[model samples]
Target chain A: MRYVLFLYAAIAFVVLAAGSIILPDWAMFLFAMALAKGLVCLGIVAMMRGGVVSFGQGLYYCIGAYTATLAANMWGLSDIFLLTLLSSAVCLIVGVIFGPMLATYRGIFFAMLTLALSMVLYGTLSKMSVLGGSDGLNIAPPTFLGWAPEGRDLQTALYIYVVAIVVIAGTLMRIYFDSEQGLITLATRDNELRVEYLGASVRKVMAYNYIFAAVLGGLGGTIAVLALGHVDPEFAFWTTSGEFVFVAILAGYMSVPAVFVAAIILEVVRSFSNLYFPNTWQLSLGIFLLIVIVTLPNGLGSLLSRRKGGKT
Target chain B: MSAGVLEVRDVQKTFGAVTAAKDISVSVPKGAIYSLIGSNGAGKTTFVNMVTGYIKPDSGEINFGSRNIAGLAPRLITRLGIHRSFQIAQLCNELTVEENMLLAGAIHHDERPSFFRHAHSAAARERAMATLERFHIAEHRNRLIPELSGGVKKLLDIAMAMAGETQVMLLDEPTSGVAADEKFPIMDLVIEALRAEGVTVIFVEHDMDIVTRYSERVLAFYDGQIIADDTPDEVLLDEKVQRYVTGGPA
Candidate 1:
């Protein structure tokens, strides 16, 4: 465990330094966007343990971004660090209220409920002019304690994502997923009847996991919103939730770090395909997902583990 | 506190027009290896489920030790010292044997079963390992549940339940449908382990040798209520229990 932490810390340091010095504006933005998406996928994997595919992640994600957006626009709460804290709190609170109803259902019913919730948010936000409606609202360049991160355009975003990555979110969640509560999540997925018999509460475990996922999702949403310097209701659509699920599936539901790799591959592939054949990027993505699902039943990390264990 | 580990009053449970368990009353004393024997659908499991708090009784009062825990959630009841193993092997098929045992211990140590305030620390691991050793499955700890044989799966399920800080254990057919050769070993291990913990064992089984061998007393169920509840010898020798078993009491 100590060795893995050391290795991850070393890697984070290298990436952080490189982003500030050698990386171009586009690369930095891509890196930050990938990291933000990676955090959202972390929440998805947390839910995935229960065999629940929540399509309402975008609803919570949008709530986080919009909370920050509203804070800045209507309330003039302009400090980025404080806004980040407030955004995460709001998302978690909303998840707390919605969790019991949303988590009580599983399989397709769960999926549809989340989708409906996200769509409702999208509809309501699109009609609200205070949120700037479809045109969206722009955020001013954020000051962290009045000292803006010394980076241009996308570089600043990459720095923010790097902060999110190192903020103990991943480490804390790693411990969580290894706990007995984590086992309850998996047990509930496997057999709710047996887990109950084994002295577990399926509803409580599901609710806790849902709320944790919302916190992570909101954190991701806050980072993403801050990165783009804008917020809009469309960001919280069911389609966006679909995209996060897609990333999680492609990454597999085991390790949190793998999500970043999956996110980067997604961005690189989508952009490359769009540049060459803009009309067929969606088709290419579909084919890629199908291939990954078929060839790697455990996801790409399985391949990495196989190689490491010398079992391939 | 009551001398009985579990004191069940006249419990009633119904499924619409169908009465699953009716006026079922039984008191399990401390340190008794009690077995419930009955044909399928005889309310053996329903009684177990109700006592364990999986299903709420329509009307009943259950006293575990001193506290009335009729409608408490399974986790809360478990903490108050009741554990259970299911008929259909409750081990997580995806995780390893050791992982499953550790998870069982983790509920008491880390996380509130609330999944918050995780107590997943080094101290928890030591206790989890000790529970694994008690079941003699420590050697096969790394193997996943699906890969294990039926007997090993049964062992894992028992170990998982034993991991909880329980004073009473309700095992629903601990050796049900396993190979005849493997049945005794599994039962002996589970009963012995739970006994070591000073936990009262109440299990439902159809096998008569098992009932007579490990159980000090037996509770016979007929049609949704306990008809003959006494020692294995007493219940087996009773005319009413014999009639029900010989297909005359229907």
Candidate 2:
């Protein structure tokens, strides 16, 4: 059954990767950006499974973007692969330092603490003119390994790159969601005391989850920076984190694939609503969210799980 | 007495002015079944809590083997082989019966849960099913906790506690919310299962009938202290126990 899921994921990856051949340049960029945001939301979904919602995930996202941009602009590094690895490494270290302390909090306290941490980063970044304070830094087009692709080909390459990362990360996350530690996380959500009495450290499980979320958030930030060609303090802004949380709520905790789907849907909706409604795009998004909440309380993922008669 | 598996000495716990446990001391022999009887707030649950590391005693020693586990965390104590069931059945209501059992198996059967291995691996599933079958709740393995009857929840609670390598099992009101007619059957299943595994059993109960039937020895509590410690018949007939604990004729 696990192998079959992996196979399905591989086939989906192939189909999505093929889209770069037919999609227009603008559409490619939109999809790439959406998938990048989806990675950030995926991290939030991971923490949500452990029964805590992070309101300030932008801390890692901003850290990732800044790390990649500074490496490129300051150190003259241009390899996209190295940039992502460096960003993820920085986020991992930050997560390790903070995950344990955050794991000790729950519910609203956890939410507020995470938000506060990100806001502090926002304040710090806004003041640091060396890394481009409010105006931010623009990223140069990146080279894939040693090959540099530009124009439409560059967009296509990036789209495929984002798809590859999402596929690999999503598959690995699905496996984690089915593992013993994963089950323990679900149990912790229901009754933490029972989990502790059963001899599993609830805090340890939560801290590990937070760290995973941070790395994924960092990866997402790197991808977003690569596609957008800019990095700024706003990456760590509370509103930016709020958007990730919004996607996470829309995706639900049940299905890993649902996260990217929700992100793409959000991007498409925002684009069309802004184009047509212009003045009321936020209103449209608000109404759309209300409808989804009223109809699918567990989010878009539950619909698929309900049909399959099992949790993904 | 056969070597005591759990020894509590001069344990004291106070919540402000009220003393919940006052210099309480008891030695539970290996493989013996002991029952704790007291009114609400008389410290029966408090004793269980202190022993299970849920509450650290204000002052005293809780010796499990030679280790002093008084101030240890609950998970550490549980990992050290002392497990307990709550007065109210604590269960993961969102998960199915088999999933709940599988979680217990994964945590206890393995030193640490693997990140890549499935929680419901064939071996883990088989162990979970065997434990469920031992308690006669195997038929409800796929059912959710809310779907089960009170007695079944009680049974599953004890069954999960026994999933590990336990030397001592503390059951806080094992039959509290169970129906009167179902109490004996649940106790019988629990005691038999624990005994078969050679686990030392200490249960808190208000049901005198259950206490007298299952416990070879009884400790009667009143106002945060043990007033009588003897065979069930002797403890039930004590003057102070009759007045303060059982409310029986003196």
For each of the candidates, what fraction of the native contacts does it recover?
0.43, 0.86
Q: How well is candidate 2 docked (DockQ)?
A: 0.74
Task: Write model 1 residue lDDT over A62-173, tens digit each, in one string.
Answer: 8878888888877888677788799899988988998887778889998888889889989998998877887778876666766665458336644644555543677677
iRMS for all predictions?
A: 4.6, 1.8
* Per-residue alpha-carbon lDDT of candidate 1 for residues B15-93, written as tens digits (9 for 90 to 100): 9887889898877888878999888888999998888888999998999877989988877787777888888887777
**For candidate 2, lDDT tens digit of each residue in B30-72?**
9999999999999999999999988989999999999999989
TM-score, each model?
0.91, 0.98
Local distance difference test, each candidate: 0.78, 0.92
Candidate 1, DockQ score (0 to 1): 0.42
**How accurate locally is residue A4 in candidate 1, as Cα lDDT from 0 to 100?**
74
Q: Ten-residue segment with the worst summed lDDT in candidate 1 chain A?
A: A303-312
Q: Give the local distance difference test score of model 2.
A: 0.92
Query: Which 10 consecutive residues of model 1 chain B have the lowest summed lDDT?
Result: B110-119
